[model samples]
Target chain A: GAGVSQSPRYKVAKRGQDVALRCDPISGHVSLFWYQQALGQGPEFLTYFQNEAQLDKSGLPSDRFFAERPEGSVSTLKIQRTQQEDSAVYLCASSLALWERVYEQYFGPGTRLTVT
Target chain B: AQSVSQHNHHVILSEAASLELGCNYSYGGTVNLFWYVQYPGQHLQLLLKYFSGDPLVKGIKGFEAEFIKSKFSFNLRKPSVQWSDTAEYFCAVNAHYGGSQGNLIFGKGTKLSVKP
Candidate 1:
């Protein structure tokens, strides 16, 4: 089975520009998650979706970030007015279901966003 | 606030040597612990997870982690590491009952360099 896939492996955005990263979860995954990993640091939670219903977004840094999983399989994380601080790898993960099983997420090759 | 700590920023070891990476979290309640590894040019992959019952959890590639409630730690260990084990290791945790269920708190990753 194909693992999770992300578009635009690397993106260089100018400060103040808007950027959208896309993720394609596994065929039947019901839970999706987004995370941001800064250089030399761990990945921080961004948001999560359970079959098109966003369950959590508290990890989002600010209002500049928005995410959607309309169809429950594909997800997008959009950043408005990108800042140098927003430069990091955006990771997407998915699991078969929620609860303890959700911890066994399969990750995609992250999209590295570099804000200039 | 919940947080994860990885004691080592970088470690260099020769092939076949024993390995141990320390990880600790600051959450009092029941939680799910995990170890993730990211090889160069690859996405983050789940090493193992500790949810309930036995504290010792074995993962892919001969990796294991022990969850200690008293110590609030889930340290990863490998008896005999190979050169292929060189990578970045991340420890993560999420609340079990309340709080954020699907969102994980990750530690600053530990970079392991193995010499063949």
Candidate 2:
């Protein structure tokens, strides 16, 4: 079975530009998550979605970052006015359920975003 | 706010050497713990998790972790490591919020370099 996958393995954006990163979660998965990983650091949670409903967006750093998962499928993280500090790897993960006693997230290869 | 801590930022060991990585979380509530590994140029994969039942849990590739509630720790250990074990390891915790599992809070990660 195909695992979670992200598109545009690498992306370079100029400061103040807008960029979008896409994620395709595993088929039948009901939960999706986004994370940001800086170089030499761990991934920080960005947002979470259950089916087509956005459950958590508290992890998003600022108003410039926004995400949506319409139709209960593919998701996209869009950053408006990219900043140099936004240079990091954007990771996407998915799980089979939302309220399982234990949720094991399957991660994608991640899209490395560079803002210059 | 809950946070995870990985004591070792980097570790170097020869093949067949024993390995142990320390992880501690700051949340006092019931939490689900996880360990993830990311090989070079690869996505993160689950190594093990501790939800309940046992304190010591075994995972893939002969990996195991011990969850100590009193100590707030979930440390990963391997009896003998191989060259292929070289990768970055992450410790994460998701606290149960409002009777539902929440997003994971990750540590800074530990980079292991195993020499054959």
Candidate 3:
């Protein structure tokens, strides 16, 4: 689209429920990223994708959090068995490919998730 | 692990006053630094970046930042503050040695309140 777009601006899930957030990055963007922002905390890196290749997932807190950019355009962040501590905003960003080597990032509006 | 630190969690200033927000990062090798701003209920937008060359970088809205290599700091500063500048600011770093590649490590963020 125009800029990065995220789906379901807000989501409320009960404990142990599963939720999925979506992201549609700017067209032709080859590098995508996911980050989690807890209340009053900075956004923490969760994962990264370079043209459908999951280059990094070191920041995911647990196996419960999984992200994928199957076609390197649209991406989804799936959280299983959501916990109260998972309440926060999930942000997605994209760049004009990783090889470009520019640190410029375009961020989406972010999905606010609350685990009840 | 590479990480970013924001010295202040909240900062209050009057319009037209000078402002500065501190940011620091931990990295052992070459790194890319950036500053992003988010207005209330708005998406994040890039303010500035420091990839190489002169450490002093200028961004939109009369904002500037200095990257001090010795101190591992990239502090954002503006000579005059405006009420519109009241927002959340984040510092991020991308290091070739940090994660896989092009993954950003963000600071907790500083909330700036410019009272007119």
Candidate 4:
């Protein structure tokens, strides 16, 4: 079975530009999550979605960061006005069910974004 | 706020050597723990998890983790590591209550380099 996958393995953007990273979760996954991993750091939670509903956005660092998962499938994380601080790897993961079920999340290759 | 800590940032060991990476998380409530591994140029893969029942849980590739509630720790250990085991290991935790149910808090990660 295909695991979670992210598109545009690498991206380079100028400061103040907008960038969008996409993620395709497994076929029957009902939960999706986005995380940001800085250099030499572990991934930090960014947002979460259950099916098509956005349940938690508190982990998003700033208002410039937005995410959506419509139709309960693909998700996109859009960062507006990119900055040097935004240079990091954006990771996406999906699970078959909620954490209560103890379902392990499968991660994608992640999209490395560089803002110059 | 919840946070995870990985005791070692980097570790070097020869093939067939014993390996142990320490992880500790701070959270007051019941929690779920996970160990994820990321090989170079690959996505994060689940090594094991501790939800309940047995404290010692075995995962793929001869990896296992022991969840010590009293110490707030979940340490990963392998009796013999292979050259292919060289990768970044992450410890993550998620609370069972509040708005952070499905969101994971990750540690800074430990980089393991295996010499064959």
Best by lDDT: 2
Each prediction's whole-model lDDT (CA): 0.92, 0.94, 0.90, 0.93
Candidate 4 residue runs with Cα over 4 Å from true position? none
lDDT of 2 by residue, B34-79 (tens): 9999999999999999888999999999999999999999999999
Which segments of candidate 1 are over 4 A away from where they belong?
A99-101
Which of the two candidates, 1 or 3, achieves a greater DockQ against the reference?
1
Candidate 3 lDDT tens digits, B21-62: 999898868988999999999988999999899999999999
Ranking by TM-score: 2, 4, 1, 3
Error of 4 at B1 (Å): 1.1
Ten-residue segment with the worst summed lDDT in candidate 3 chain B?
B95-104
Per-model TM values vs. the true structure: 0.96, 0.98, 0.95, 0.97
Structure candidate 3, residue pairs in collision:
A42-B108
For residue A14, give model 1's deviation from the true position in Å: 1.3
**For all the candidates, what are their Cα RMSDs to the real structure?**
1.4, 1.0, 1.5, 1.2
lDDT of 2 at A101: 54
In model 3, which runs have C-alpha deviations exceeding 4 angstroms?
A: none
> Once model 4 is optimally superposed onto the true structure by TM-score, how far is the C-alpha of residue A89 displaced, in angstroms?
0.4
iRMS of each prediction = 2.2, 1.4, 2.3, 2.1
lDDT of 1 by residue, A5-116 (tens): 9989999999999999999999898889999999999988899999999998988999999999998889999999999999999999998866455557889999999999
CAPRI class assigned to model 4: medium
Q: Provide the fnat value for model 3, as a fraction from 0 to 1.
A: 0.71
